[model samples]
Target: MSKPKAVVIYSGGMDSFTLLNRVINENYDVYALTFNYGQKHVKEVEVASTVCQTLGVAHKILDISPINQLMQSSSLVGNIEVPEGHYEDDNMKSTVVPNRNMILLSLAIGYAVDIEASKVYYGAHAGDHAIYPDCRPEFVNAMNDVAKIANYEPISIETPYLNSSKGEILKDGLTMNLSYEHTWTCYNGRAKACGKCGACVERLEAFSENQVTDPIEYE
Candidate 1:
């Protein structure tokens, strides 16, 4: 019997990298889908390509640049600077790309259905719910419903880390010997991660909580 197929909504960030490994570990014939939505985190697209190559998985980069035009308010799409602080800080809301997960998941589900994949996996965790509304549990559930209704085949959204903390997710990835250094999390889209951005701050804190130093470089 063949292994089940899973489509991973990969962003080449710590959380999604961990989720990608988890899906691979579970023996899924994985396909990685990444989006180039003209966000400031363009480096993540390159990182995603590298990570997928390292894992020997088929990867696709979808162009959703129209999102940049639709959601111009976000620091990710506009000249507004990405806020620097902890994930829990309210100012981090500036980084929210409006309905980002919704758009990504919709496209992912369509791809998954075309490929006859049974599941689509994403890495929405508790750590993101504060600022990213689309990462919240309710949004995931609603999107899952939409996927079910939209597809003729049985397809579902799988968010195993939906309620898990970033530390817990990282620990699982570490157990699988996944490399964290290849992942990019900074919103600044620079050569080196700005250590003060909300993404950097949260990732550092997760590593601290896990008692492991992050292998990624930060400026």
Candidate 2:
């Protein structure tokens, strides 16, 4: 029998990129699903496409403008300022989109059902909990229950990094042989990481904690 297939909700961010690598390491037939949710970083969509292509996996990009319209708290969606500094700091709250994980998981579940996949991988991690409540293990478990009930064939949601810090995620990615250089996690929507944005701060901290050098360019 062929290995069961899995779909990864990739966004070309560090965590999602690492999650994609983890799914691939499991040796399941992997497919990548990206969303164009009117984010400031449309470049992430392109990066996600390229990452999927490089991994030789099937990829899909969904138009989720309605979802984008529903989110305004996040600087990523509207004319809001991208906060600077560490994600764990108070300034990072500006980036928290309301119900982002709920929306993403709901859409991913629909796509997983359509694609006949039983497992969906997401990159919600401990590092996100300071700003994103939906990234927590409780929310993930709740969403998994929803997916199980919603899908005719039943499905499982995997968040391998749920309890792991960003540093741990980066280390796991290395073990999975991921090419981190191509992934982008900047909230500034620039060609290089702004280095001052919360996402950039987190990425840098993760690498530093791991005692590893991050290969991505930053300005």
Candidate 3:
């Protein structure tokens, strides 16, 4: 029997990395999609490419850099400095790209429909709710509604980690024996991860919670 097809919204971050591996392990033929939206962390796009190539997973990367001019207030897409602190710190709100996940999910849905794939796997988790409004459960629910009616061929948004914490998501990935070295989490595009950045801090906390060493290098 043929496996079910899925479009995985892969950012090459830990969450999406884990989700991509999990969906592949679940017997889905995966098509990974990475976005190049002029974020400082475009290194993640390169990581996604390498991981997909090594895993023999079909992958597509989209360049949507023109919108960066509209979202200049965001540290992720603009020249602003990324705030360094714990994930829950209010200053970390600077990293929230305006409607990023909405834009990504919309494109992923279009890809899934184009390929006749029934599902689009997203890596949204509870940890992002404190910072990114688009990663909230309410946003997922609303997007699911639009995904259904946006086209005659409905595509389901599957968020297996919707209620899971970052630590829990890491645990699941570790259980699958997936390596985190293939992922990139730092908000900055430095050669080494800045451990003090909010993205690095949250990722380190997840690794600490799992009692596992993060395979990625940091400075």
Instruction: Provide C-alpha RMSD values for all models, in order.
Output: 0.9, 1.3, 0.8
TM-score per model over all chains: 0.97, 0.95, 0.98
lDDT, residue 71, candidate 2:
83
Note the residue pairs that clash in candidate 2: none
* Candidates 1 and 2, the one with greater lDDT: 1
Instruction: Flag the better candidate by lDDT, 1 or 3.
Output: 3
The local lDDT score (0 to 100) that residue 202 gets in candidate 1 is 87
Q: Residue 90 CA error for candidate 2 (Å)?
A: 1.9
Candidate 1: stretches off by over 4 Å: none
Using lDDT as the measure, the top candidate is 3
Q: How well does model 3 score by local distance difference test? A: 0.93
lDDT (Cα, tens digit) per residue for candidate 1, span 8-89: 9999899999999889889999999999999888999999999899879999999888769888889988888888899889
After superposing candidate 2 on the true structure, give the runs of residues whose Cα lies further than 4 Å from its correct spot: none
lDDT of 2 by residue, 114-185 (tens): 888999999999988888889988899888998899857788999988999999999888777666888888
